[model samples]
Target: MPKFAETIFQIMKKFFLSTTVLAIIACLLWATPFTAIKIGLKYTTPLQFAGLRFFLSGLIILPFIKDFRVKVKEASKRWRFVLWVALLQTTFLYGLFYTGISYVPGALGAMLIGAQPLFAAIMAHIMLRNDKMSWQKVFAILLGLSGVCIISLGRADFVFTTTIPIGVGILLLNNIVGSTGNVIVSRDAKNMPPRVLASFSMIIGGAMLLLFSIPIEHPNWTAVHPGEYYISLGWLAMVSALAITIWFGLLGREGVKVSNLNTWKFIIPIFGACLSWLVLPNENPDTISLIGMFVIACSLLLVNFLNRRAQKAQVRLSSMASH
Candidate 1:
C-alpha cells in the first residue's frame, strides 16, 4: 500500500511542472470573474460593476505608482499611447465583457473568453516580426477555436437570437480589441513594469467606464447589500490585479511568445465551469460542455508540446553553430 501511494504521488508530481502548475492556478483565479460578474450584477449594472471593479483594481496598485511616474516622465509623450492601451485593455475590454456576460450563461461566457488566444495569435503575428505564425500554430489555434464552437453549438439550450449573437459578437470584439492592445504593448517593448502599466491603464479605463455608466446606468448604491458588494468587489479586484500582473510578466518573459502564453487560457473555461458548478446554483455543466472542455484541454497540451519540441530543436541548432 505504501509503495502504491508513493507511485501515485510520483505520477501526480510528474504530471505538473512548476510553470504548468502556476498557469493552472492563474487560469482558475481568472475564471472567477464570470461568476463574480454574475453575483455583482445582482447589485449593479454591468458597466457600473465593471467600472468599480477595475477602479479598485487600479487603486490597489497605487502604492507602487512612484516608479510608474518616473517611467512616465521618461516616456512623457506616451500618455496618448497609454490611453489607447487603457481604452482597449480596460475600457472596451471589460465594458463589452461585462455587458456580454449579462446575456450568456457563465459557462458560455467562459467558452467565448477562451477564444481570446486565437485572436491574440493573429494579432501577434501581424504586429511582432519575431512572433510570426507557423502552420502548426495556426492549426493549433483553429483546434482551440473549434472547441469553442462545439461548446456553443452543441449545448441543448442553444438558439439563435438577435440578442445572443450581439452578446457573443461583443465578447469576440472584446477579445480582438484586447489582443490588439497586447500586441501594441509587446511591440513597444519599453520594458515598463507590468504593475505600473496595469495601474495607470486600469485607472484611466475605469474612470472612462464610470463616466459612461453615470449617464447610462445611474447605478443605485442603496440596492446592494454591503457584505455581498464588498465581497464581490474584493474578489474581482484582487483577481484582476493578479491576473494582469502575471499575464504581463509572462508576456515579458524571454522566449515566451504571446500566443504560446495565451494558448493556456483554454483552461479558463474548464476551470470556470467546474467552479461555477461548485459555487453558483443552477450552473452544472452537461455532457456537451464536458466534451468541449476535453477538446480544449487536449488542444492546449498539443500546442505546448509542439512548442517545446520546436524550442529544443532551435537550441540544438544554436549549440551546433557555436561549436
Candidate 2:
C-alpha cells in the first residue's frame, strides 16, 4: 500500500475503534442503569438496595488488586479527601438517586441524572483554574438547564405538587453531589490506582448508606425475593465496577478535563430514554420530553465542539511560540 493511503486507512481504523469503544462505554454507564434500577426497586427499599449494590461493587474489585493495603495507608493520610469523595459521590448521590427513581418514571429519572454534566461543567469552571468556563460554555450551561426544565414542566401542568417536586429536587441534588464528587475525584483521586480508588471510596460510601438505611429504611432482609435481590446486586455491581473504574481512569488520564469528558455524558438521557422505552415500555417519554432531549443533545455538542476547537487553537499557538 502507498504510504499516504496507508496513513489514511490507519486513521480511519483508529477512529472507528475509538468510536466503538466510547459508544459501548457510554451505553453501559447510562443506558443499563435506568432499567436495572427500576427493576431493583421492586424488591427492596431504596437505601438498602443502593447500599448493598455499591458495597458489593467495591468488594468485587478489591480482590484483583495487589498492595492495596499499602495504598490504603496512603489513602488514609488523605482521609479527608477520600471520605469527602465517599460522602458526596456514593453516599449522597446514590441515596437520592435510588429514592428519586422510585417516585418517577425510569426515563424521567434518567433524564434528570443526564443533567449532571451541566453541573459538572459549572463546578469545574469554579474549581479548576485551567478549566475556566468560556462564554460558549456558559451559554451551553443555560441551554442544558432549559432542556431539563422543559422536561420537568412537560410532565405535569406546571404544578409543583406532591411527589413530583420532591422527586425532581432529589434528582437535582443528586446531580450537584455527583458533579462535586467528579471534580474532587479529578483533583485528588488521580494519584491512586484507579481501581483501588474506586473500590475503597465505594465501600466507604456504601457503608455509610447501609448504616443509615437500617435505622431509617428498616429493611426486612427476608422480604426481598432471592431472584430480585441477586439481579439488582448483579446489575448495580457491574455498573459500579465497570463504569466507575472507567470513569476514574478517564479523569486521571493526561489532558482530560472534568468538563471535557463530562460534556459527552449529556447523551446519557438519549440512550437511557431509548433503553427505558425498550425494556420498561411504560416509561416512554412524551413529545415535549423528546424535544427537550434534542435540545440537550445540541447543547452538549456545541459545548464539546467549542471546547475542542479552543484546545486545538491553544496547542497551535504553543507550537508557534516554540518555533
Candidate 3:
C-alpha cells in the first residue's frame, strides 16, 4: 500500500477499536431494530411480537454468561429491583414503543426514539443530585423539543384525523418510561451484575408482556406468517441481545466516562432515519421532516460540545488545585 493509504488505514483501525466507536456501534445496532420491528408488526400484533423478541433476547445472553445459575441465584435476591426494571424498561417501554411504531412511519418513529437522551438528561437533572441541569443542557432540551414539534407538524394532515397524534404521544411517554428505567438502574443496580439483571429482567418482562397480550391483543397463533416476519423477529432479538451486551461491557470498562460514552447515541437518529428511508418502502424523506432531523442533530452536537467543555474545565481546575 502507498504510505498515505497505510497511515489512513492505521488511524481507522485505532478509531474503530476505541471505546467511543464501540458505543457508536452499539447505538447503530439499536437503531437497526426499529425497521425490523415495523416489519415484524405487519404480520403479528405488537405485544406478542415484543414479548417473543425480548424473551429470546434474554435467552440468547444466557449462554455467554459464566456460572449463569450462580449469577441468577445471586441476582434473585434483588428480585424487586429486577422486577421494577423488567416492568418499566422492557414491558412498558417496548409495549408502548411497538404499538406507537405501528401507527407512524419508520423514519418518524426513529426520530422520536432518538429523542430519548434529551428526556434522559431532564430525568437525571431532577433525580440525581450531582446531575443538575446546566444552562446549556436546558437550552439543548428546548432545541430538542422544538425539533420534535417540527417533526410532528410535518404530519399536520394526519395529526388530528388519524392516530398519528396518539402514536406520537405514546412514543414520547415511552421515552419517559425508558428514562425512568435508566435512573433506577443507575441508582439501585450498583451492586447488581448487569448481565444477570439484563437477562432475568428481560425474561420476566417478556413473560408479562406475553400474558398481557393473550387477553388484550387476542393474537392469532394459528395464522401462518411469511419468512420475512421470522427474519425480522430473529434480527430484532439479536439486535437487542448484542447491543445491550456491548453497552453493558462498555459501561463496566475502566476509565470510560458514562456521559461521554452516551453522547455517541446522538448518531442513532441519523442512522435510523436514513436506514428507514432507504429500506422501508413507504418511508421517504420529507423536506420538513429532514429539517426537523437536522435541528435535533444540531442540538445533540451542541450538548456534546458543552459536555466536553465542562469536563475539560473540571480537569484544569483539579490540576490548578493540586499545584
Candidate 4:
C-alpha cells in the first residue's frame, strides 16, 4: 500500500475508535458504579469503598501492564510530570469521586464528573493558542448551568433541598480538579502512549492513596466480602482505564473536542438518570427529578455549542490567512 493510503487508514481507525470507545466506556463505567455504590451503602462506609476501589484497582491492574513502571533514578529527569499528574488526576480526583459516590446516586456522580467537558473547553480555550472562544460559549455555559440546577433541585414540587448538598459539593470539586488535571496532562506531559499513561496514573495514585488508607483501615478479614469488590474492580479498570485510555489517545489524534461535534456527553445525564433510577429503584427518581435531569442534559448539549464555535473560529482564521 502507498504511504498516503496507509496514513488515511490509520487516521480513520483512530477516529472510529475514539468516537465509540469514550462513549461506550462512559456508559458502563457510570452505570455499574452507580448501582454498586448503592449496594455498598448497605455493606460499608463510603470511605471504605473509596479506599478499596483504588487499592484493589491498582493491585488487579498493575501486573498486566508492566511498561508504565519508571526507573527510579531517571524518573526525576524524564517522568517528573507523572508524579504531579498522578497525584492530582488519580489521587485526589478518584478519591473525591468514590467518596462522592457514597453520598449520591451513581448516575448523579457520573454526570457531575462528566460536566468536566465544559470546564475542559474553557481550559482548552485559554491554554491552546489556536482554539479561540466566541459568544456561543458564553450562552452555552449559562444554559448549561441552568440545566445543572434543574437536575439537582427539581422534583414534583418536592425539591431535593437540604439533603444531598455535600454530595454535590464533592462532585463539583472533582469536576474542577479533574479538569485542571486534564489541562496539565494535555499541556505539560510528553506525548506518551495512552496505556502507559493509564498505568502510571493507577500505580502512583493507588500507592499514594494506600499510604493514607493504611493507618485508618481495620482488617475485617472475616467480614469483608470479595464478590462485590471483584465486580467493581474489574469494571472500573477495564472500562474506565483501558477503554478511556484508548479514547483519550483518539481524542489527541481526532481533535480532543470532536466528540462534542456529535450529541456526545449530553446523553450522560439521560443515561445517568435512567440507569440510576432503574439500577437503584430504592432511590426512586420521580418525574420532576427526571425533568431536572433533562435540564442538565440540555445544558450539556449547550456546552457542545461552545465546542462548535471554537472550531468555526479556527476555520475562519485559516481561510483568511490563505488569502
For all predictions, the C-alpha RMSD in Å is: 5.2, 4.0, 4.3, 5.2
Off by over 4 Å in 2: 1-24, 66-70, 100-111, 144-160, 163-169, 280-293
What residue pairs are clashing in model 1?
none
Please give the lDDT score for candidate 1: 0.78
lDDT over C-alpha atoms for residue 172 of model 2: 87
- Model 3: worst 10 consecutive residues (lDDT sum): 254-263
**Of 3 and 4, the candidate ranking higher by TM-score:** 3
Better model by TM-score, 2 or 4? 2
RMSD (Cα, Å) of model 2? 4.0
TM-score for each candidate, following the candidate numbering? 0.84, 0.82, 0.80, 0.70
> What is the Cα-based lDDT of residue 141 in candidate 4?
53
- Each prediction's whole-model lDDT (CA): 0.78, 0.77, 0.78, 0.59
- Backbone atom clashes (below 3 Å) for every candidate: 0, 0, 0, 3
Cα lDDT of model 4 overall?
0.59
What is candidate 4's lDDT per residue for 133-231, written digit by digit as tens?
Answer: 556665655555455446554422333545368988988888777766766665555465555555566677777766665555553435665587557
Candidate 1 vs 2: which has more lDDT: 1
Sorting all predicted structures by TM-score, with the top scorer first, yields 1, 2, 3, 4
lDDT of 2 at 52: 86
Query: Global CA lDDT of candidate 3, please?
Result: 0.78
What are the per-residue Cα lDDT tens digits for candidate 1 across 277-301? 7986877778887888788877887
lDDT tens string, model 3, 107-130? 467568767777777777777675
